[model samples]
Target chain A: MPPLPVITGLGFITSIGQDRATVGRSLRELQHGFERVEFFGNPNLPVKVAGTIKGFDFPTPSWRDWRWPDRFTVDRELLRGLAPHGVYALCALQQALTEAGLEPGELGDGTTGLFCASAGSPFMLGSFLGQMRETRGERGNPMGVVSSIAGTLNFNLATHYRITGAVCGFVSACASSSHALGYAMDEIRLGRQQRMLVVGAEDMTDESIMAFSSLRALSNNPDPATASRPFDRRRDGFVGTGGAVALIVEDAALARRRGAHIIAELIGWGQAGDGHSVTASHPEGAGLREAMRRSLADARVNARDVGYVNAHATSTVAGDRSEALALHATFTSQGARPRVSSTKALTGHGLSLAGVMEAAFCALAIDEGFIPGAAHLEEPDPVCTGLDLPRTSLAEAPGLVLNNSSGFGGSNVCHLLRRPA
Target chain B: MKTSAPSPTASTEHEQSIRHLPAPARAAFEQFQAGGDPATLDPVVLAILADFSPRASEIPLADLPGDTMLIDDLGFDSLAITEVVFAAEDLFRINITNEEIVQVRTLDHLRGFIRAKVAGRSAR
Candidate 1:
């Protein structure tokens, strides 16, 4: 039998923390990183706060002018064609590769692959096109389209990191990174790649954030503490956050041979589309339930053995209820009640970034012997009655974990992971 | 036009050197210089192009010669030239076509094109 696929390294440049140590502390302490920002200088952009990042200062849109943090030494010339999220992704990759003990030449192995996700850099896109409009389209930025489109991360990362093997980008709205993670795992398990780096990020500008306000999917809660209460009865809509996350997945034998620290085993994954609506999910979370069931079957693990479920509930009324129904249908009928929570309650929904970020969260839980609880969950919605929704962090090791991620167009993806044995 | 000035090499300069200035740009440069009232181009164009030059870190922008080849000496690709053009457009508020600038090979050639475009803009 082939060696199993396992996550050997993790890197996070998130609002919650820039490194695993800080992230572990934040998760253990149940603290959140939320701040108010002027959305494109407009005071009235629905939500008032987000899980915002504070370091790696850039004085201008030109990346050459950026003052990178001390931990990350950058070759500024390589950043000329990258967008904001692309820049964050590169930094996250550096951290991940360093943690994995892989040098540049090793990462350049033809057997290695990179699967990345981002909704593109809307901030850069808006600025690029807006400038073109002002110029009457007579002139164009040389790097405009490359840096602004949904494939920005792929273009910038594959080129900068010298990835000689398979490189791909996933774009299923918020489920984008989860899809990337699953595909990366599949590539490794099938022996197509010795290693695959799954990474994702998004921009936090008004252009990126306010684009969702018209859909009425943003939290209007003025209070940051309770704004993203995932399963609470008072849940309105999701709060947004942006940063980057990277996880290095490789053959378990390869990792052990290299003495790499194995974080968790990526047991199985499943993806499905509701075919029901463009925005609203299936009323009964039909596709999500199918995804969860398929994931369990793929891993060949009984539903009862799953110790925790990182819920996809993003605090939206219909969304949370649908996921709850999916959970109840998937677990309750089988008399299985795994501990459930959405760390989005702490780190605001990261949109396209949620999948890989939350997957990294599950890995952290496995390694650190704790399950992140629903940070602000209170007064659970009636739909959540049967499912186990822990309101506080548990100090016990979560033996196995399933992370669920859902997005627009009724796309659902679930990844099941187990503690490294 | 065919009279050899000792160094009038045969074959079309257009087809010969992607690195060196083509015949048209050289002709344009000589024509403008012969006018006696040489145009005083702004420093902004040089400032912009210097940033895009790949050799800037070693040669330094101030040391690059006027007749220095942007492609060969300054090490600029087609995309880098386009970026230089974009910067010039924003600075001079004028438009330049790819066909008009693709054959330009030197800083002087670039200056001549910008002088003509800026003059045209002023006339408009």
Candidate 2:
């Protein structure tokens, strides 16, 4: 059949770390990235903590001046109109392209495409609403209009890079980026595009935090480090967070021809809709099971051959339990149950960004031969107990890994990644 | 995340300029003036200039010559010029129509237009 798509470059920024090396190191050191909410701290709110990126200043004049080199000069002034998610996507894409040694408009004959996933522009909407209230909607920031669009990230990146090929945006909630990455793989496999950049970005605002708090879907634990304990008995819910991740994906032959450093082989991708709930996952995890099975089947790899499973366990009572049931049904029935864990335990739930970040984590794990432990995972619940939820880093790398990502709308996406030979 | 627009720091002289401004403009300008450099700068004017200038370009805002042309000297494009006007409107909480914006050429001209708007508002 067609050649497998490979990841040539990876760039990610999260509460855990900014780059792969640093994130891997942090994982090994058992350093959790969650911290007290910096934006909003309502003492009465049930959730008081999040996986916040401390002092995150992207495109900030002073921050960029010191951090970015002259060659990477960007017109920060022009970007002032973009939403935070848009900025995060552009920054992540820049890093990925730089690492891949590609410049804007240099993607070889425009066969390059872009796929972006975002949890809408909540931050900009909030700011715009406030501005509208203050200005009585008569006068507000002109940029407010651009930032309010959900496709801001996709449109901004495509225009900035001049990627004249297919540009698409996916809004599958938490599974959004996973769907983006999966579709990018499909395009390459279908010979529709030679290269694609998959991006996932999110901007968590006080409104989002309050929304989750209203739903009682956030962890009430005041401790940032241990608040997001996936699969643990004490787990309450995911800690809200925001960040971005980008992956430069290309046809395996094209990547090898370009002599790009192949990070991992994206072998399979599967997506399914549970059709069960608007906000909650299916208790039986029927959709998740189908997604995993489809992913393995698409990869043409046996379930027994899989080495690790990056679970979409958000630490909520129903979410984690449902994911565990899906995992047990998908991997356990087959011989050699793969080790399963959720990096969300450290990075928390970055909404639309969660999928791609966790997928990137799997790529890093394969590249470095280290599987990160599910941080703060103590006293695993009986329903999730059978799975090998290692609390410490696995020194040896697995040959293949499965990344499971699901969203509020019962959208589930699974990706199978393999170590590049 | 708001774009890191150059916030206008009202100087003592800038604050003095507010006295001549109308009540609405003075109130708006005072908010801009709060917690900024006390140097003799008309922050509103300086902010409008700085917003349109290139980030790395050496455009000295503190001591701008009154005769400097916005285009030839500062290299502001059409869009950049529009952004300056928008920023001004947002800061001063005043409505600057497109027709009025086109007539503004120099930094001094723009400053005069703002002063006129504030004075016009006070007359109401």
Candidate 3:
């Protein structure tokens, strides 16, 4: 409605690297995080590779003191006793708040809202399912059912952060966080809240692994180095990765007054549904084209102003074709095409976390003046032959960047970002 | 072929009013089944499962064959099994007791259990 809010600070955790510098270096080098995991019971599932996070130590010691109940046991045994999405959201929020130099009480009571996008159910589901299967002959624990619901994560995150403002969770499949960011930006732009915390968190689980494997939508190229090759002709599918990202967005005037380091401005956002199939995207990329056009229109910027585009190309056979066609059509119609690149090749598909993680990358790209090329792309798809996908590195100073996320069920979102003058 | 036994009904009639779930709710249901194992399951289901299994790494779901004993075949201790049960109950919005859990040995059984709970709730 009003002028969109500005992103003051950003934080993300992914398999490629944790901090910005480390992740930035990996992206610049085009490093891949895929590797074979023997823990999955199926030795013949074809896709043995994944972009897994290693050596992450949780800061909360209280989790260790808690009782190892049925659900807790699942967390401990399967997830290595890590905190759920709610807890991760809180932790990421804390970091974003700290980066923005805001105290716990600074945002004032009931003025600070929490908005998040999550693709996975809480980590408790697998443990409960395993328990249900094992305890089939006995009475199951009552707490397991309660702890495993999807909404519980949002509720817990709000309570843990002591956020009194509106609390909403957006679940648009892979576009979950992108939509959440767009919504949060709109809320702040309309003067509903002084500050908003937007988060995208995911917890990869077994059901997710098998589901992708069954569809052959995962890269089976055992070598972690070459597993996720987005835009590459030999690309098989995406590497399922996990992580959380948090961004603190506030009014540009308010942030500058407080001397906060303004990273980028969220000028426009567009959301659309394909009304297409539930799993695959439309071949012509009609939904994606509309979303991008709408975003540019909302930003009041011409297509020529866009410096780079962060694509949602997950390296799938159908998905890549659809996205490429969409980009070509959109840019051709405007007579000005921007350089397009897919980061999923490096980070794998983070699902709900992808939008925010890539948003963080966009912010970094604007600041760093370089758009990382698609990681293992030796040859672009023939369908995308006409598109100007950056195979080699490009170091153009970006004035504006657009991030695209297309999810299952025809959900698509595009966010237009501008470098702060 | 004998049809599988139907699931238990929901406790309240008021909860049965809504039959079709919006995209988010359906997504949550699919996610519940793919818990903690994204590599094997469908991406849609994996997206849902990721919600609950944040720390879930790559584990093959095929190893968890329908006929495989949850404890013996899967090498899951009591705690792991309980987590899976909790996920099912939460996603399906049904109350599955320890006794009901004991009857679920395979993926098919788990799906049936959830369907029965939903059906029962709708019947009310």
> Per-candidate interface C-alpha RMSD?
12.1, 9.7, 8.5
Q: Provide chain B TM-scores across all predictions.
A: 0.62, 0.61, 0.48
lDDT of 3 by residue, A1-421 (tens): 3545888877656777755677777767777666677535678667777666654432222233323213111233323333454445545666677778888676548767878777545446666567558545233433455345545445556655578887898888899899889988888888888778888887555554556676677777777777777767788788887767888888887788899988889999998888899898988888999999999999999888988889999988788888888888888666877888888888888888899889888987887778778777877778767667777667777678999999989999999998897
Candidate 1 chain B weakest ten by summed lDDT: B1-10
Of candidate 1 chain A, the 10-residue stretch with the lowest lDDT total is: A56-65
- Give the TM-score of each candidate: 0.87, 0.84, 0.71
Give candidate 2's fnat, 2 decimals: 0.17
Instruction: Rank candidates by TM-score, best first.
Output: 1, 2, 3
Instruction: Give the residue spans of candidate 1 off by over 4 A.
Output: A56-61, A64-68, B1-43, B53-59, B64-75, B90-124
Cα error, candidate 2, residue A231 (Å): 1.2
DockQ of each: 0.18, 0.17, 0.03
Ranking of candidates on lDDT, top first? 1, 2, 3
TM-scores of chain A across the candidates, in order, are 0.98, 0.93, 0.89
- lDDT of candidates 1 onward, in order: 0.82, 0.76, 0.69
- Model 2 residue A93 distance off true place after TM-score fit, in angstroms: 2.7
> Highest lDDT: which candidate?
1
Q: Which residue pairs collide, candidate 1?
A: none
User: In model 2, where do residues sit more than 4 Å from their true spots?
Assistant: A1-3, A57-74, B1-46, B52-56, B61-82, B87-95, B102-124
* Candidate number of the best TM-score: 1
Residue pairs of candidate 2 with colliding backbone atoms? none
